[model samples]
Target: MSAASERAAAAEGEQLARTLAVLRETSDRPLSFVTAGAFAALDEGGSEPLAADAESGTVIPANGLVLLYGDGGAGKTTLVLDMLVHLASGEPWLELVMPARPLRICLVENEGPRQLFRKKLARKLAKWPRAAETIRVLEEPWQGVSFRDEAQRDEFVEFVTAQKIDLLVAAPIARLGMQGGGTLDEVAEFADLVADVQRRAPGLAAMLVHHPNRAGQVSGAWEGFPDTTMHVQASGHGRTRILWQKLRWSSLLHGKTTHLLWADGESFTVDEREAVTASTMVDEILAAVLESPGASWTKLRPRVRGNETEKAAVRDRLIADGLLVNQTAREGQFRLWHADDPAATRSELRTGLERLPFPTPEREAAAVPVPPFQRSIGTVERERHGRPGSLVADCLICDHPFSVDDGSPAMRCRACVALTADLVTEREADQMRLLERLRVREALRGAA
Candidate 1:
């Protein structure tokens, strides 16, 4: 062999020997190939799904890395804290079931100070005090440890194993002292480190919180590292929506978004009503346009129930699907029409409006169905002296015409008054139901 070839062979041999030595030192059992038969014989029933609901299938995978990312002040930490609390309490979170027994968790909070974390934790524990017993927080001196440092890594593994931690939460992965500059190599190194920890402490799941890029996406190659990736965005009115951006192993939550409403300090409740299915929203939009053809977006959006972002998204989707048509009307206002309509131009729509059965303003007002109990008791008077004594006045609430004897001042009709009373009663009943639900949840927690 040539001189250079001999030197290269010797260097490769030294590197392999060092690698083998490190593996031998770190591994608890002797290294051996996992044969196909042995792998097949392994117990599959022991594996559990991470953050899953019994009915909804797998959300996140167990013993694997998961990523949660969002913009600042988007309630990412709040959501995760709630989740960990539920897991610790052995209760369900946003319908996701937890283990029957409490799971040990180590929260590495890097963004906030210890006092701030304390306040947050206190609020979360107000309802479920038992969860506090299982959760551990590691705050300061976090930067001193890095996966690249063998001693530090070993210490971390020891801590995980010693505490019997089932889950490790690293808040804002950037703060973790993983020393590479968001490169492929850095991600690979982090993944290897996580795998090592998981192997050492079986059933350990790692959740890494991260920040998105300017375009609102996972910042780097770190996206590919997690078995599941979730994105949180603020939906209006103290509510946030979580979108499953990536699910490598399971397709259960793919394309499905979960919404959470802030109920109290550090508390979130799932708003199932606001979680309207896409098909339902589409149907609502189509029906609205069918009722009021040529309605502008400004007028039609209010009739829908979703936030502005969702409304716009569904609108764009409808247009793309060719289920709805948009045309520029007078003053550049965008007018929407059902795609099945034959009206191709503004003038055509106007002409068609006259011929179509679309209800006019007066017709719509007259179409309001008045209850039999609201029939006027007074007889209609043709005229008293020179003009009719009884005049027609529209109801202040329903706009239905009612007789005003001797031109009496207009007021809400009897039917509207009854309807208003019914609405108020319904609202009170809803409030009572909500309170009952809260009480039941508290009772269940106490029982557990």
Candidate 2:
């Protein structure tokens, strides 16, 4: 093939079409196998096992693009930094678990340099309790320019062809061009960019750090594109949780994991998972925790109505998840915990109210007027099947009470929906206040 033909074939814009064709053809079968194989072969320098599940390695193909999106202080950077160090140290993705290969990460971050990255990297590496030098961390901008004009797209395509990256990490896709597109449409365009990247760097897993939409969706090109999509959020008060809203190839889709992250002097390290609860409980826990450096689990547990086992489980889970840490032993009492870690705290602020302790209630499967929008609440409005008032309902987000009656259609109660909305708004406002305080504190410290 001529050099020109070779360049054209390598171009992401062109290759993306071919890749989509292949995807369609193999849609009947699992495409992950091919993607995983491609990833495994692309980088084979290190054979050491890092972290894996019993069934398979923790890292796999179609591990695709792991987008970690959060607000400014959501510890997104810290999490990436920690991962870089942890992977390098050959530490397991989770405690006692091992991966088949050391995670070879390429961070196209807009932050950090050789010194800062290394200093933070060192601290995180030490916390892993594993040997350093097992992983490879590469820091470079995986650039791609976009334009409304086809000529600009083609120019950027040529640039990507020149730099054949295995894993591209882009920060805030909003900052890509000279700024002239609608935000939502830009999001769609961004999603297309991700699709394009996957085509050219077939072996690469592009992880993008982004912000969430106002309606609480993974903002940009969100019309069904991610193989795995997770929302990293903090319980308004202080606990940090990363929930998998969508997972194409894994079972973590509905899975919610709490993460306690702390900076051990430099980069943030995630400790473990915490208890899961209804959205209200999450909001309450965060509210209580953020007010003070710590809150007694004893006093807080009942607010969420967790049993002894559940409370203990949440405590233990928090410690494991790296969202909470042991503050003091007090010689002979049940250990108390605090949001002592920076990563966990930052993550909490990042997610704000999105990850509030909400429960996933069963859908009617084919209910009319989607409850949130429907104005009715009880059987008086909708027929209760001629039976006595025996209807029970709950909020889709917080599992709070909604009423059911025998009249017209289905809906949430005034008090229940109002409470949910109030809680959500309160938590959000509280986060802003907390962030403001943090900002002031930082300014004072910097001035000093």
Candidate 3:
């Protein structure tokens, strides 16, 4: 090795040895112990193993690392603000009952400017004035405040410790910046930084808000470090759902979700929506099915436009429709496909069926009884996910999905339920057959 390289290595080794020596010299005697000590320690003190901090009934432990991540425009900012407001005010989170005593919370927004936060605060002020007073926002973060920058991290740790902050929010952690990387990549560096902070201030808990990658997973080493992970999603109509996706300490919140609505402009309100239950699943199923026609059970399962209450409603909506048929074909062991799709083989019957006009004549024919319980299953979807044309309905008999005429009572298309003057009796059927034979005989004689 070169002289300088060797010298540098020796210096690092000496520093490490000195640090170890200092730790050994200033440490408690016979410190390390086994499972018995852990058992006794647990038995001796501490109120509860873990308790909820900001979220009611949810335990966000002291010195815990939590990640609240979501898609780019999932309203993470609004949701996080609401959470902090509850934490500061000792209010229930969507009636989940937050900590009885409010914890001192600090939200350091690395992304949004002071103006944006003001706008947010102003919107929520009327409803959460008291909570707003307790929560603190740091507009200007110290330069180079990152795990990669030890000095800045140390300063932040000191700040958190001195302020007696309970929860510290680090937003868009990418802004924190990393120095270099290890074998495990950038996430390891982030974890190290967080560890350093926790060591300095044991009472300080961290909640990092981050964005998802293209594949919809939290970017970087977030999953590796945080003891708890909450997946946030925007469910449209200014509504957001924060799914407590994983928690290392507790299973009470596993698969549990909370919905938050952000109503802004002219007026502002943050409200907790009711969780989807069995009764509500039917409505959710109807809305989703309306959005996506011909969507099979497998496709509809993951497309949770609304919360899941009844698992069975996924298939029941179509089964209830009774108008549309499952032309879904199976590919190999598990994959399913739409059977009527030309991608497989275009059936002449299906083509003819789709081309037929709406059943205007069938509804007009008074003699024939209209099918009982005619559900106008709106426009036949050209492709499974294609937009529904105005007033779409399906044919009952041939299972042909068709567009219904506006204000039409007919469920079946004209082609499916052929319009005859009246329901044929046995003698009428025989007379019709005899007339057909006589016409064929005359045609043959003329040809000869």
Candidate 4:
């Protein structure tokens, strides 16, 4: 054949391929002619769908976007590290019943490296059921690689597809896509980028890690695109909890709390925070009380908001929720607020405070206390822990740790937990006493 004829034939073949691709995209249903049976014999094919009962923790489905967000040091990355180890080792995910298929994961962490990640993974997988060989890692060290414009996204997508990956994990979504929501176009485009990655890989899961907004919501337009969204936050230093902020297949809502604690070495597991309403108001009032013990309502209102009545309503609502109390006063001043009953009250406050309005970083930092003990193993010289008890633990509602008997259940520390019984009885007695004192004071004032 002539060289010119050979070139013409190659061109014709390229044109045919492009035409077929175009038709696939334009079709009402993509690749409709290829029946499910065609792929049935392949190992990747025809497995029973993931069980509806599989979802449990803050994470549910293994497909589409899964977001984990919180303030800095909220352990968003730590939780992701735990999940990655679970995926790599084939351990039963604490909340998920059906294990994800043996999958390849390409994760990008802007802050860490392959060696450190591998070390962490090794530590994690040592406790689980499977060998480390089944998991694959593609690390992008610099933060810039994942968010590189559309061209980079497309290229990365192509690279992932070529690898036949079953899962993709990207840490800190800001590094993976456009950061600011400056305009509607930018927001939509960011959402589209996330959705596009999912669409491009139907069988693969794309889990993006992001820091939560000051209000405790996920950041970026992509936040709304995920099939599941989770908020991992620290209720105390060295102790972090995970909550389901949203889920496509689960009934869990925002602030449905669960805890995950770091164990021996890098191992960690989930602890369910007893389900509670996501009450921002309740949180604010509790925070005010902690910031100022014996604070009066006049003073409390300002803590909720020094200048704004509308914002103060949030605090009033919290009082109505019974997360806070109005302790009657001795003089003309309004009642004071004392922490309500419940050992978990302070923990819940931590949960809510992390979600409050701007300047949240400072507020959250103030809430994280230095853990009393840091050594994972062995005896270190102990410093005197001042106070009346041997172990001082924070009231979950008020963040006040008190000494208690070692063997008792933790429910007693919080004033909120004892609300219905002992704690309420104590509060009522105090209230009556305060009211009597107020009446006597009024009589004196009238006489004067």
Best by lDDT: 1
Stretches of candidate 3 above 4 Å error?
A: 1-58, 122-127, 141-144, 179-183, 264-448
Cα lDDT over the full model 4: 0.53
- Ranked by TM-score from best down, the candidates are 1, 3, 4, 2
Q: What is the lDDT of residue 236 in candidate 2?
A: 50
Model 3 quality (TM-score): 0.56
lDDT of 4 by residue, 1-448 (tens): 9999997688557646754775687785645455577766556532332222244422434445666678897766666766666666555556543344445667667656667766776666676545355555555446566443545667667977887766677766666655465245666655556665656666667776777666666655544566677777787856777667677666644435567777665546665444333354456667877677546566766545223554456555655555455443122333334444332233234422111112232343355654332112112222353322133344444444433332222322334333322234567644644554453343334334
Worst 10 residues of 1 by lDDT: 351-360
Task: Output the lDDT of residue 316, model 4.
Answer: 55
Per-residue lDDT over 85-129 for candidate 2, one digit per residue giving the tens place of the 0 to 100 score: 555454554342343445445444444355775676566666664
TM-score to true structure, per model? 0.60, 0.42, 0.56, 0.49
Question: lDDT at 303 for candidate 2?
Answer: 58
Tens digits of per-residue lDDT, candidate 3, 210-259, equal 77777787766456577789998888877777788777766667667766
Model 2 misplaced stretches (Cα beyond 4 Å): 1-63, 96-98, 111-166, 177-188, 236-239, 263-302, 305-448
Q: Give each model's clash number.
A: 0, 45, 8, 20
Q: What is the lDDT of residue 123 in candidate 3?
A: 81
Query: Which parts of model 1 have CA positions greater than 4 angstroms off?
Result: 1-41, 44-46, 139-143, 274-278, 295-448
lDDT of each: 0.68, 0.48, 0.58, 0.53
| Candidate 3, residue 175: lDDT | 74
